[model samples]
Target: MSLDLDYLKLKIELFLLRKKAKKTFPEDLSNLTLWSQSTGLKVAVIDNDGFNLKTNLESIGVSVTVFYDYFKPVSQRQEKRKPYPFSQYDIILCDINDVASGNDGFGELQGVGAIEALRYNFPFKMIIAYTGNPAALSRRIKKEKSSNLVDKIYDKQWAPEDFMETFKESSKSFSNPEARWQFIRNRLTYLDAKEKEIDKIREAFVYSCLLKGNPKFLLRADAELENLTQSTLKFLQQGSMSDALRSGLSGLGLISDVFGIVAAIKGT
Candidate 1:
Protein backbone atom coordinates (compact mmCIF):
# COMPACT_ATOMS: atom_id res chain seq x y z
CA MET A 1 0.00 0.00 0.00
CA SER A 2 2.03 2.96 1.33
CA LEU A 3 5.83 3.22 1.10
CA ASP A 4 6.36 3.09 4.83
CA LEU A 5 4.36 -0.10 5.14
CA ASP A 6 6.32 -1.63 2.31
CA TYR A 7 9.64 -0.98 3.99
CA LEU A 8 8.54 -2.56 7.27
CA LYS A 9 7.39 -5.74 5.60
CA LEU A 10 10.82 -6.38 4.13
CA LYS A 11 12.42 -5.84 7.49
CA ILE A 12 10.01 -8.21 9.22
CA GLU A 13 10.56 -10.87 6.61
CA LEU A 14 14.31 -10.53 6.89
CA PHE A 15 14.12 -10.66 10.67
CA LEU A 16 11.93 -13.73 10.58
CA LEU A 17 14.29 -15.43 8.18
CA ARG A 18 17.27 -14.75 10.41
CA LYS A 19 15.38 -16.12 13.40
CA LYS A 20 14.56 -19.16 11.36
CA ALA A 21 18.15 -19.46 10.23
CA LYS A 22 19.36 -19.31 13.81
CA LYS A 23 17.01 -21.96 15.11
CA THR A 24 17.57 -24.42 12.30
CA PHE A 25 21.29 -23.87 11.82
CA PRO A 26 23.35 -26.72 13.19
CA GLU A 27 24.86 -26.20 16.65
CA ASP A 28 28.36 -26.85 15.35
CA LEU A 29 28.17 -23.66 13.31
CA SER A 30 29.05 -20.46 15.10
CA ASN A 31 25.97 -18.32 15.85
CA LEU A 32 28.26 -15.58 14.62
CA THR A 33 27.49 -16.62 11.03
CA LEU A 34 23.99 -15.12 11.22
CA TRP A 35 25.31 -11.85 12.61
CA SER A 36 28.49 -11.78 10.52
CA GLN A 37 26.89 -10.14 7.51
CA SER A 38 26.29 -6.79 9.20
CA THR A 39 26.40 -6.34 12.98
CA GLY A 40 30.14 -6.83 13.46
CA LEU A 41 33.21 -4.64 13.31
CA LYS A 42 34.30 -3.48 9.85
CA VAL A 43 37.59 -1.99 8.72
CA ALA A 44 38.84 0.20 5.89
CA VAL A 45 42.41 -0.29 4.71
CA ILE A 46 43.78 2.66 2.71
CA ASP A 47 47.29 1.73 1.78
CA ASN A 48 48.70 1.69 -1.76
CA ASP A 49 49.35 -1.92 -0.94
CA GLY A 50 46.04 -2.40 0.84
CA PHE A 51 44.95 -5.53 -0.98
CA ASN A 52 48.04 -7.35 0.11
CA LEU A 53 47.17 -6.52 3.69
CA LYS A 54 43.49 -7.14 3.02
CA THR A 55 44.06 -10.85 2.65
CA ASN A 56 45.57 -11.00 6.12
CA LEU A 57 42.76 -9.03 7.73
CA GLU A 58 40.05 -11.18 6.19
CA SER A 59 41.73 -14.25 7.59
CA ILE A 60 41.27 -12.75 11.01
CA GLY A 61 37.53 -12.13 10.47
CA VAL A 62 38.11 -8.50 9.59
CA SER A 63 36.02 -7.41 6.61
CA VAL A 64 38.20 -4.86 4.85
CA THR A 65 37.08 -2.23 2.35
CA VAL A 66 40.31 -1.13 0.76
CA PHE A 67 41.34 2.01 -1.10
CA TYR A 68 44.42 2.44 -3.20
CA ASP A 69 45.55 5.01 -5.86
CA TYR A 70 45.31 7.64 -3.16
CA PHE A 71 42.46 6.09 -1.22
CA LYS A 72 40.02 6.56 -4.09
CA PRO A 73 37.36 4.01 -4.93
CA VAL A 74 38.51 1.57 -7.58
CA SER A 75 36.55 1.47 -10.86
CA GLN A 76 34.36 4.36 -9.72
CA ARG A 77 33.91 7.56 -11.71
CA GLN A 78 36.63 10.23 -11.39
CA GLU A 79 34.22 12.80 -9.93
CA LYS A 80 33.68 10.68 -6.84
CA ARG A 81 37.40 10.91 -6.01
CA LYS A 82 37.59 14.11 -3.96
CA PRO A 83 36.60 13.42 -0.33
CA TYR A 84 38.05 9.87 -0.23
CA PRO A 85 35.18 8.75 2.05
CA PHE A 86 35.05 7.00 5.41
CA SER A 87 32.97 3.82 5.33
CA GLN A 88 30.84 2.35 8.17
CA TYR A 89 34.02 0.53 9.01
CA ASP A 90 34.61 0.54 12.77
CA ILE A 91 38.38 0.93 12.39
CA ILE A 92 40.53 2.82 9.89
CA LEU A 93 44.08 1.77 8.94
CA CYS A 94 45.50 4.61 6.89
CA ASP A 95 48.90 4.84 5.25
CA ILE A 96 50.50 8.24 5.59
CA ASN A 97 53.07 8.68 2.81
CA ASP A 98 51.15 8.80 -0.46
CA VAL A 99 47.38 8.39 -0.24
CA ALA A 100 45.51 11.55 0.55
CA SER A 101 46.62 13.56 -2.53
CA GLY A 102 46.26 16.77 -0.55
CA ASN A 103 42.50 16.36 -0.18
CA ASP A 104 43.11 17.22 3.45
CA GLY A 105 45.09 20.32 2.37
CA PHE A 106 48.30 18.83 3.75
CA GLY A 107 50.92 17.79 1.16
CA GLU A 108 53.22 15.41 3.00
CA LEU A 109 50.79 15.44 5.85
CA GLN A 110 47.58 14.68 3.95
CA GLY A 111 47.15 11.35 5.72
CA VAL A 112 47.40 13.18 9.02
CA GLY A 113 44.83 15.61 7.73
CA ALA A 114 42.58 12.67 6.84
CA ILE A 115 42.98 11.41 10.37
CA GLU A 116 41.89 14.80 11.64
CA ALA A 117 38.87 14.77 9.34
CA LEU A 118 37.96 11.20 10.28
CA ARG A 119 38.30 12.01 13.96
CA TYR A 120 36.00 14.97 13.45
CA ASN A 121 33.50 12.88 11.51
CA PHE A 122 33.51 9.92 13.87
CA PRO A 123 34.72 11.14 17.23
CA PHE A 124 33.86 7.84 18.87
CA LYS A 125 35.31 5.51 16.22
CA MET A 126 38.86 4.17 16.14
CA ILE A 127 41.31 5.62 13.57
CA ILE A 128 44.71 3.97 13.15
CA ALA A 129 47.50 5.36 11.02
CA TYR A 130 49.65 2.90 9.08
CA THR A 131 52.99 4.42 9.89
CA GLY A 132 54.97 2.66 7.17
CA ASN A 133 58.36 3.36 8.65
CA PRO A 134 58.08 2.83 12.38
CA ALA A 135 61.64 4.05 12.91
CA ALA A 136 60.64 7.41 11.53
CA LEU A 137 57.24 8.20 12.95
CA SER A 138 56.82 11.82 11.84
CA ARG A 139 56.42 14.85 14.05
CA ARG A 140 52.84 15.49 12.88
CA ILE A 141 51.97 11.86 13.54
CA LYS A 142 53.35 12.06 17.06
CA LYS A 143 51.55 15.33 17.71
CA GLU A 144 48.24 13.80 16.61
CA LYS A 145 48.80 10.83 18.87
CA SER A 146 49.48 13.03 21.88
CA SER A 147 46.37 15.05 21.15
CA ASN A 148 44.54 11.82 20.34
CA LEU A 149 43.70 12.75 16.78
CA VAL A 150 44.38 9.10 16.04
CA ASP A 151 43.94 6.11 18.27
CA LYS A 152 47.21 4.41 17.19
CA ILE A 153 50.06 4.48 14.69
CA TYR A 154 50.89 0.95 13.45
CA ASP A 155 53.63 -0.21 11.12
CA LYS A 156 52.45 -2.24 8.16
CA GLN A 157 55.54 -4.42 8.13
CA TRP A 158 54.70 -5.98 11.47
CA ALA A 159 53.41 -9.51 11.67
CA PRO A 160 49.67 -9.74 11.03
CA GLU A 161 48.98 -11.14 14.47
CA ASP A 162 51.00 -8.37 16.05
CA PHE A 163 49.27 -5.73 13.98
CA MET A 164 45.77 -6.82 14.97
CA GLU A 165 46.86 -7.10 18.57
CA THR A 166 48.17 -3.56 18.43
CA PHE A 167 44.98 -2.53 16.70
CA LYS A 168 42.91 -4.02 19.50
CA GLU A 169 45.01 -2.26 22.11
CA SER A 170 44.41 1.07 20.43
CA SER A 171 40.69 1.21 21.05
CA LYS A 172 38.04 0.00 23.45
CA SER A 173 35.11 0.64 21.10
CA PHE A 174 36.08 -1.87 18.37
CA SER A 175 35.11 -5.59 18.05
CA ASN A 176 34.89 -8.49 15.60
CA PRO A 177 32.09 -11.06 15.68
CA GLU A 178 34.99 -12.36 13.56
CA ALA A 179 31.51 -12.07 12.01
CA ARG A 180 31.30 -11.34 8.29
CA TRP A 181 27.15 -11.17 7.62
CA GLN A 182 29.02 -9.99 9.17
CA PHE A 183 27.81 -7.28 6.73
CA ILE A 184 31.37 -6.30 8.18
CA ARG A 185 28.53 -3.93 8.53
CA ASN A 186 30.38 -2.48 5.53
CA ARG A 187 28.48 0.70 5.35
CA LEU A 188 30.57 5.27 4.79
CA THR A 189 29.64 2.40 3.89
CA TYR A 190 30.60 0.80 0.53
CA LEU A 191 31.19 3.65 -1.88
CA ASP A 192 29.00 7.12 -3.36
CA ALA A 193 26.34 9.70 -5.06
CA LYS A 194 23.09 8.03 -6.32
CA GLU A 195 24.63 4.66 -5.51
CA LYS A 196 25.44 5.98 -2.07
CA GLU A 197 21.81 6.82 -1.32
CA ILE A 198 20.73 3.36 -2.42
CA ASP A 199 23.33 1.65 -0.26
CA LYS A 200 22.36 3.63 2.82
CA ILE A 201 18.85 2.19 2.65
CA ARG A 202 20.32 -1.25 2.13
CA GLU A 203 22.61 -0.93 5.12
CA ALA A 204 19.91 0.50 7.36
CA PHE A 205 17.70 -2.48 6.58
CA VAL A 206 20.30 -5.08 7.47
CA TYR A 207 21.66 -3.18 10.44
CA SER A 208 18.22 -2.51 11.85
CA CYS A 209 16.66 -5.89 11.10
CA LEU A 210 19.45 -7.82 12.78
CA LEU A 211 19.51 -5.70 15.88
CA LYS A 212 15.75 -5.21 16.35
CA GLY A 213 13.94 -8.35 15.32
CA ASN A 214 10.79 -7.29 17.14
CA PRO A 215 7.49 -8.89 16.15
CA LYS A 216 5.45 -5.73 16.62
CA PHE A 217 7.01 -4.21 13.53
CA LEU A 218 6.30 -7.36 11.52
CA LEU A 219 2.70 -6.20 11.02
CA ARG A 220 3.86 -3.28 8.95
CA ALA A 221 7.42 -3.84 7.90
CA ASP A 222 5.34 -2.96 4.87
CA ALA A 223 5.95 0.64 5.91
CA GLU A 224 9.56 -0.35 5.91
CA LEU A 225 10.49 -2.00 2.58
CA GLU A 226 8.07 -3.31 0.00
CA ASN A 227 6.05 -0.21 -0.74
CA LEU A 228 9.17 1.86 -0.47
CA THR A 229 10.63 -0.22 -3.26
CA GLN A 230 7.58 0.11 -5.50
CA SER A 231 6.53 3.66 -4.55
CA THR A 232 6.40 6.05 -7.50
CA LEU A 233 8.77 8.75 -6.37
CA LYS A 234 9.06 12.28 -7.70
CA PHE A 235 12.81 11.95 -7.25
CA LEU A 236 15.05 9.12 -8.42
CA GLN A 237 17.25 9.49 -5.34
CA GLN A 238 14.43 8.53 -3.03
CA GLY A 239 13.65 5.52 -5.12
CA SER A 240 17.25 4.32 -5.44
CA MET A 241 18.03 4.33 -1.74
CA SER A 242 14.97 2.34 -0.72
CA ASP A 243 15.10 0.01 -3.68
CA ALA A 244 18.79 -0.50 -3.14
CA LEU A 245 18.07 -1.27 0.51
CA ARG A 246 15.61 -3.94 -0.49
CA SER A 247 18.24 -5.37 -2.77
CA GLY A 248 20.76 -5.30 0.05
CA LEU A 249 18.44 -7.19 2.39
CA SER A 250 18.07 -9.96 -0.14
CA GLY A 251 21.82 -10.23 -0.40
CA LEU A 252 21.86 -10.65 3.38
CA GLY A 253 19.35 -13.50 3.13
CA LEU A 254 15.85 -12.00 2.95
CA ILE A 255 13.03 -14.30 1.83
CA SER A 256 13.15 -12.97 -1.69
CA ASP A 257 15.86 -11.25 -3.60
CA VAL A 258 12.86 -9.88 -5.47
CA PHE A 259 12.20 -8.09 -2.12
CA GLY A 260 8.67 -8.31 -0.83
CA ILE A 261 5.91 -10.63 0.22
CA VAL A 262 4.02 -9.14 -2.71
CA ALA A 263 6.59 -10.84 -4.93
CA ALA A 264 5.54 -11.15 -8.61
CA ILE A 265 2.44 -9.04 -8.00
CA LYS A 266 4.45 -5.90 -8.86
CA GLY A 267 5.04 -7.11 -12.43
CA THR A 268 1.42 -8.06 -12.98
Candidate 2:
Protein backbone atom coordinates (compact mmCIF):
# COMPACT_ATOMS: atom_id res chain seq x y z
CA MET A 1 0.00 0.00 0.00
CA SER A 2 1.11 3.58 -0.66
CA LEU A 3 2.30 5.69 2.27
CA ASP A 4 -0.44 7.88 3.75
CA LEU A 5 0.95 11.13 5.16
CA ASP A 6 -2.13 11.89 7.22
CA TYR A 7 -2.08 8.46 8.76
CA LEU A 8 1.58 8.77 9.60
CA LYS A 9 1.04 12.15 11.22
CA LEU A 10 -1.83 10.82 13.30
CA LYS A 11 0.20 7.88 14.51
CA ILE A 12 3.02 10.20 15.60
CA GLU A 13 0.63 12.63 17.25
CA LEU A 14 -1.14 9.83 19.09
CA PHE A 15 2.20 8.42 20.21
CA LEU A 16 3.18 11.82 21.60
CA LEU A 17 -0.25 12.21 23.22
CA ARG A 18 0.00 8.78 24.79
CA LYS A 19 3.39 9.68 26.20
CA LYS A 20 1.89 12.83 27.66
CA ALA A 21 -1.12 10.94 29.03
CA LYS A 22 1.21 8.56 30.84
CA LYS A 23 -1.05 5.51 30.59
CA THR A 24 -0.78 3.19 33.53
CA PHE A 25 0.86 -0.17 33.02
CA PRO A 26 -1.46 -3.10 33.50
CA GLU A 27 -0.65 -4.70 36.88
CA ASP A 28 0.31 -7.77 34.95
CA LEU A 29 -0.70 -9.06 31.51
CA SER A 30 -4.15 -9.96 32.81
CA ASN A 31 -5.99 -7.32 30.80
CA LEU A 32 -3.61 -7.79 27.91
CA THR A 33 -4.07 -11.58 27.94
CA LEU A 34 -7.83 -11.25 28.02
CA TRP A 35 -7.59 -8.82 25.13
CA SER A 36 -5.38 -11.34 23.34
CA GLN A 37 -8.05 -14.04 23.49
CA SER A 38 -9.77 -12.25 20.65
CA THR A 39 -6.37 -11.54 19.08
CA GLY A 40 -4.86 -15.02 19.73
CA LEU A 41 -1.40 -14.10 21.04
CA LYS A 42 0.91 -16.77 22.48
CA VAL A 43 4.21 -15.37 23.77
CA ALA A 44 7.50 -17.08 24.57
CA VAL A 45 10.61 -15.59 26.16
CA ILE A 46 14.22 -16.73 25.71
CA ASP A 47 16.84 -15.15 27.93
CA ASN A 48 19.97 -16.26 29.80
CA ASP A 49 18.66 -14.21 32.72
CA GLY A 50 14.93 -14.89 32.52
CA PHE A 51 13.82 -14.81 36.15
CA ASN A 52 12.22 -11.35 36.20
CA LEU A 53 11.02 -11.51 32.59
CA LYS A 54 9.55 -14.94 33.16
CA THR A 55 7.59 -13.70 36.16
CA ASN A 56 6.35 -10.65 34.24
CA LEU A 57 5.27 -12.70 31.22
CA GLU A 58 3.45 -15.17 33.47
CA SER A 59 1.70 -12.35 35.29
CA ILE A 60 0.35 -11.23 31.94
CA GLY A 61 -1.06 -14.75 31.42
CA VAL A 62 1.24 -15.62 28.54
CA SER A 63 2.62 -19.15 28.39
CA VAL A 64 6.32 -18.28 28.53
CA THR A 65 9.38 -20.53 28.00
CA VAL A 66 12.83 -19.34 29.03
CA PHE A 67 16.04 -20.58 27.38
CA TYR A 68 19.33 -19.79 29.08
CA ASP A 69 22.90 -20.33 27.82
CA TYR A 70 23.51 -23.53 29.80
CA PHE A 71 20.21 -24.93 28.53
CA LYS A 72 20.67 -24.07 24.83
CA PRO A 73 22.85 -27.00 23.77
CA VAL A 74 21.30 -29.84 21.80
CA SER A 75 23.32 -32.48 23.61
CA GLN A 76 21.43 -35.39 25.09
CA ARG A 77 21.59 -33.84 28.56
CA GLN A 78 20.45 -30.45 27.28
CA GLU A 79 17.78 -32.05 25.10
CA LYS A 80 16.47 -33.80 28.18
CA ARG A 81 16.13 -30.48 29.95
CA LYS A 82 14.34 -28.52 27.23
CA PRO A 83 11.39 -27.00 29.09
CA TYR A 84 8.63 -26.49 26.52
CA PRO A 85 8.42 -28.07 23.09
CA PHE A 86 9.75 -25.43 20.65
CA SER A 87 6.56 -25.66 18.60
CA GLN A 88 4.27 -24.71 21.49
CA TYR A 89 4.72 -20.94 21.40
CA ASP A 90 3.67 -18.36 18.82
CA ILE A 91 6.24 -15.71 19.78
CA ILE A 92 9.87 -16.06 20.92
CA LEU A 93 11.79 -13.46 22.95
CA CYS A 94 15.55 -14.02 22.64
CA ASP A 95 18.41 -12.38 24.48
CA ILE A 96 21.56 -11.46 22.57
CA ASN A 97 23.91 -11.81 25.50
CA ASP A 98 23.16 -15.52 26.05
CA VAL A 99 26.24 -17.77 25.94
CA ALA A 100 26.13 -21.56 25.98
CA SER A 101 28.28 -23.32 28.61
CA GLY A 102 28.40 -27.07 27.94
CA ASN A 103 30.29 -29.03 25.30
CA ASP A 104 27.35 -28.49 22.95
CA GLY A 105 27.17 -24.77 23.68
CA PHE A 106 25.47 -22.51 21.13
CA GLY A 107 28.34 -20.02 21.65
CA GLU A 108 27.19 -16.39 21.99
CA LEU A 109 24.41 -16.85 19.41
CA GLN A 110 24.04 -13.06 19.41
CA GLY A 111 23.66 -11.52 15.98
CA VAL A 112 22.34 -13.10 12.80
CA GLY A 113 22.96 -16.76 13.63
CA ALA A 114 20.35 -16.99 16.35
CA ILE A 115 17.79 -15.22 14.16
CA GLU A 116 18.59 -17.58 11.29
CA ALA A 117 18.22 -20.64 13.49
CA LEU A 118 14.86 -19.53 14.83
CA ARG A 119 13.61 -18.87 11.30
CA TYR A 120 14.95 -22.14 9.91
CA ASN A 121 13.67 -24.22 12.81
CA PHE A 122 10.29 -22.58 13.37
CA PRO A 123 8.82 -21.03 10.26
CA PHE A 124 5.45 -20.39 11.87
CA LYS A 125 6.55 -18.36 14.89
CA MET A 126 7.51 -14.70 15.37
CA ILE A 127 10.76 -13.70 17.09
CA ILE A 128 11.40 -10.63 19.20
CA ALA A 129 15.15 -10.03 19.59
CA TYR A 130 15.35 -8.61 23.08
CA THR A 131 18.95 -7.57 23.58
CA GLY A 132 21.14 -5.16 25.48
CA ASN A 133 22.96 -4.60 22.20
CA PRO A 134 20.45 -2.49 20.25
CA ALA A 135 23.07 -0.96 17.95
CA ALA A 136 24.25 -4.44 16.95
CA LEU A 137 20.71 -5.74 16.57
CA SER A 138 19.76 -2.77 14.39
CA ARG A 139 22.89 -3.24 12.30
CA ARG A 140 22.12 -6.92 11.82
CA ILE A 141 18.54 -6.27 10.78
CA LYS A 142 19.75 -3.68 8.29
CA LYS A 143 22.24 -6.12 6.72
CA GLU A 144 19.86 -9.11 6.56
CA LYS A 145 16.54 -9.78 4.87
CA SER A 146 15.28 -11.59 7.98
CA SER A 147 12.54 -9.10 8.71
CA ASN A 148 10.13 -11.99 8.30
CA LEU A 149 11.83 -13.82 11.17
CA VAL A 150 11.74 -10.88 13.54
CA ASP A 151 8.44 -9.27 14.39
CA LYS A 152 10.18 -6.73 16.65
CA ILE A 153 13.68 -5.93 17.95
CA TYR A 154 13.90 -4.29 21.38
CA ASP A 155 16.86 -3.41 23.55
CA LYS A 156 16.84 -4.91 27.06
CA GLN A 157 16.73 -1.47 28.68
CA TRP A 158 13.41 -0.65 27.02
CA ALA A 159 11.97 -4.15 26.61
CA PRO A 160 9.50 -4.40 29.48
CA GLU A 161 8.05 -0.90 29.35
CA ASP A 162 8.38 -0.04 25.67
CA PHE A 163 7.32 -3.46 24.45
CA MET A 164 4.24 -3.31 26.58
CA GLU A 165 3.43 0.15 25.22
CA THR A 166 3.95 -0.99 21.64
CA PHE A 167 1.78 -4.06 22.15
CA LYS A 168 -1.06 -2.03 23.60
CA GLU A 169 -0.88 0.51 20.75
CA SER A 170 -0.78 -2.18 18.06
CA SER A 171 -3.68 -4.06 19.63
CA LYS A 172 -5.77 -0.92 19.71
CA SER A 173 -4.89 0.12 16.16
CA PHE A 174 -5.36 -3.31 14.59
CA SER A 175 -8.86 -3.65 15.94
CA ASN A 176 -10.24 -1.81 12.91
CA PRO A 177 -7.67 -1.49 10.18
CA GLU A 178 -9.86 0.64 7.89
CA ALA A 179 -10.69 3.21 10.53
CA ARG A 180 -7.11 3.23 11.65
CA TRP A 181 -6.00 3.95 8.12
CA GLN A 182 -8.39 6.86 7.78
CA PHE A 183 -7.37 8.23 11.13
CA ILE A 184 -3.73 8.12 10.15
CA ARG A 185 -4.43 9.82 6.82
CA ASN A 186 -6.16 12.72 8.53
CA ARG A 187 -3.38 13.11 11.05
CA LEU A 188 -0.72 13.20 8.37
CA THR A 189 -2.56 15.96 6.54
CA TYR A 190 -2.81 18.01 9.72
CA LEU A 191 0.86 17.46 10.50
CA ASP A 192 1.93 18.56 7.04
CA ALA A 193 -0.04 21.77 7.39
CA LYS A 194 1.18 22.29 10.95
CA GLU A 195 4.79 21.79 9.87
CA LYS A 196 4.50 24.50 7.27
CA GLU A 197 3.05 26.89 9.83
CA ILE A 198 5.80 26.05 12.29
CA ASP A 199 8.42 26.60 9.62
CA LYS A 200 7.06 30.08 8.96
CA ILE A 201 7.03 30.87 12.67
CA ARG A 202 10.63 29.70 12.95
CA GLU A 203 11.76 31.85 10.00
CA ALA A 204 10.14 34.95 11.48
CA PHE A 205 11.65 34.20 14.88
CA VAL A 206 15.14 33.76 13.40
CA TYR A 207 14.95 37.03 11.42
CA SER A 208 13.80 38.95 14.48
CA CYS A 209 16.52 37.41 16.63
CA LEU A 210 19.26 38.16 14.09
CA LEU A 211 17.99 41.70 13.42
CA LYS A 212 17.99 42.49 17.15
CA GLY A 213 21.76 41.65 17.25
CA ASN A 214 21.58 40.26 20.78
CA PRO A 215 24.13 37.50 21.44
CA LYS A 216 21.82 35.74 23.89
CA PHE A 217 18.91 35.95 21.42
CA LEU A 218 21.13 34.68 18.60
CA LEU A 219 22.25 31.71 20.72
CA ARG A 220 18.65 30.86 21.59
CA ALA A 221 17.64 31.23 17.93
CA ASP A 222 20.52 28.96 16.91
CA ALA A 223 19.33 26.29 19.32
CA GLU A 224 15.78 26.61 18.02
CA LEU A 225 17.07 26.36 14.46
CA GLU A 226 18.96 23.18 15.29
CA ASN A 227 15.89 21.66 16.91
CA LEU A 228 13.68 22.49 13.92
CA THR A 229 16.19 21.06 11.49
CA GLN A 230 16.46 17.86 13.45
CA SER A 231 12.69 17.51 13.71
CA THR A 232 12.28 18.02 9.97
CA LEU A 233 14.98 15.49 9.23
CA LYS A 234 13.34 12.94 11.50
CA PHE A 235 10.00 13.30 9.69
CA LEU A 236 11.74 12.96 6.32
CA GLN A 237 13.53 9.77 7.39
CA GLN A 238 10.32 8.23 8.70
CA GLY A 239 8.51 9.01 5.39
CA SER A 240 6.03 11.04 7.39
CA MET A 241 6.88 14.37 5.73
CA SER A 242 4.57 15.30 2.87
CA ASP A 243 5.73 14.73 -0.69
CA ALA A 244 4.30 18.13 -1.55
CA LEU A 245 6.50 19.76 1.07
CA ARG A 246 9.58 17.89 -0.12
CA SER A 247 8.92 18.68 -3.80
CA GLY A 248 8.59 22.41 -2.98
CA LEU A 249 5.27 24.18 -2.54
CA SER A 250 4.84 25.41 -6.13
CA GLY A 251 4.54 21.84 -7.40
CA LEU A 252 1.92 21.11 -4.76
CA GLY A 253 -0.17 24.16 -5.87
CA LEU A 254 1.00 26.16 -2.83
CA ILE A 255 2.06 29.80 -2.99
CA SER A 256 5.68 30.12 -4.17
CA ASP A 257 6.29 32.59 -1.34
CA VAL A 258 5.89 29.76 1.16
CA PHE A 259 8.67 27.86 -0.57
CA GLY A 260 10.89 30.96 -0.55
CA ILE A 261 10.21 31.45 3.14
CA VAL A 262 11.08 27.84 3.95
CA ALA A 263 14.23 28.02 1.86
CA ALA A 264 15.33 31.24 3.55
CA ILE A 265 14.86 29.70 6.99
CA LYS A 266 16.77 26.55 5.94
CA GLY A 267 19.58 28.65 4.48
CA THR A 268 19.96 30.59 7.73
Winning candidate number (TM-score): 1
Ten-residue stretch with the least lDDT total in model 2: 252-261
Report the lDDT of model 2 for residue 189.
Answer: 46
Q: Any residue pairs clashing in model 2, and if so which? A: 5-188, 6-184, 6-185, 6-188, 6-189, 7-184, 7-185, 29-60
The 10-residue segment with the lowest total lDDT in model 1? 259-268
Question: All models: lDDT?
Answer: 0.49, 0.45
| Tens digits of lDDT, candidate 2, 109-155 | 44345555665555334466777887876765677754454656776
